[model samples]
Target: MDERKIRVVVAKPGLDGHDRGAKVVARALRDAGMEVVYTGLRQTPEQIVETVLQEDADAVGISILSGAHTFYFTKIIGLLKEKDAGDIIVFGGGVIPDKDIPGLLEAGAGAVFGPGTPTSVCVEWLEKAVADKRAKEQ
Candidate 1:
């Protein structure tokens, strides 16, 4: 497997109009030599899952800043599992509260980055998560 060319799908789900962070993270991931497919904004969980399938992505990076992280994250994870797409590592960033992090992780999200997290941190964690998931699948 190509370690440096990790394929990622960056998605903005629900009515979250705040996309500045998503764009920045997408650019940073691209700069890190990862293939990034970004969904502009206002995407549904179904749409995001479809994008993942179409891209054949190894991981998904969701950006949620509309205080709807739990809702969207749970929905996406649930739908992904329902489709037997559990091999795809799910992670995200945004204004996520500390209290909700555990729930998100338990819901099949490999990681969650809160506000003030560096882009480099996300990039590193994403790579490791993808590698780990791939290892488990094998």
Candidate 2:
């Protein structure tokens, strides 16, 4: 496999104004040596998907606390499939209820982190996930 940094797009699904969690995770991912592109704030699902394709990102991490997690995740994942980019990993973190996790996963979210989960956990998982994905492509 070619030796290249894993690229990721971190987005705040355009609805909620709060992006503290998104910023924190973006910094952690960057610190972990991944190439991270943070889509400032209030990004529509369409914009986020566009960035992922433009960056050739291996994954996208969405930070949503707007109680719109299901809506955004389903829409983004569907859009990716429509774009024939379903192989791109879609993971996220935010204030989400436990009951909604399975539905999110079913909708094609690779994983979902809840509030207070350690950022290191996200980084480790993402690194492994992207590495595995790259290996499979090879």
Candidate 3:
């Protein structure tokens, strides 16, 4: 990984067994030159947060298809803040409703990718978010 590579943790939290989208997003981030760590399926919010800290990731990308994004996203955001990891850019992709996008952002999601959104879009968002985040930190 490049020293400047944006490290990201891609996770599927809770009982969400559908991971095709998560794996695809992970690959997209990797192809875009980010260092991606795929946490596989069935991660709890706690486990995801722990992995994020251990990896010292620049961002976290979650994919949920079990229709539990609101609960999980809020939980993850709370845990992240508790861990003092609120600086990490949090994003997600899945069958999320359009109305939920705004709320997710309010809850700390930097970006939320809906179904049919292209991989390039995700990459661009991550690239810009990581750059902007690092710039602000410095």
Q: Using TM-score as the measure, which candidate wins? A: 2
Off by over 4 Å in 1: 1-4
State each candidate's clash count.
0, 0, 0
Regions more than 4 Å wrong, model 2: none
TM-score of 3: 0.96
lDDT assessment of candidate 1: 0.90
CA lDDT of 113 in candidate 3? 89
TM per candidate: 0.94, 0.97, 0.96
How well does candidate 3 score on lDDT at residue 53?
98
Winner on TM-score between 1 and 2 is 2
State the TM-score for model 1: 0.94
Local accuracy of candidate 2 as per-residue lDDT tens digits, 1-138: 557998999999877988899999999999999999999988889999999999999999999888999999999999999999999999998989999999999999989999989999999999888888888888
lDDT of 3 at 96: 91
Candidate numbers, best lDDT first, in rank order: 2, 3, 1
Tell me how far the alpha carbon of residue 28 in candidate 1 is from the true structure, in angstroms, after superposition: 0.7
How many pairs in model 1 have backbone atoms within 3 A of each other, for residues 3 or more apart or on separate chains, i.e. clashes?
0
Model 1 CA lDDT for position 130: 78
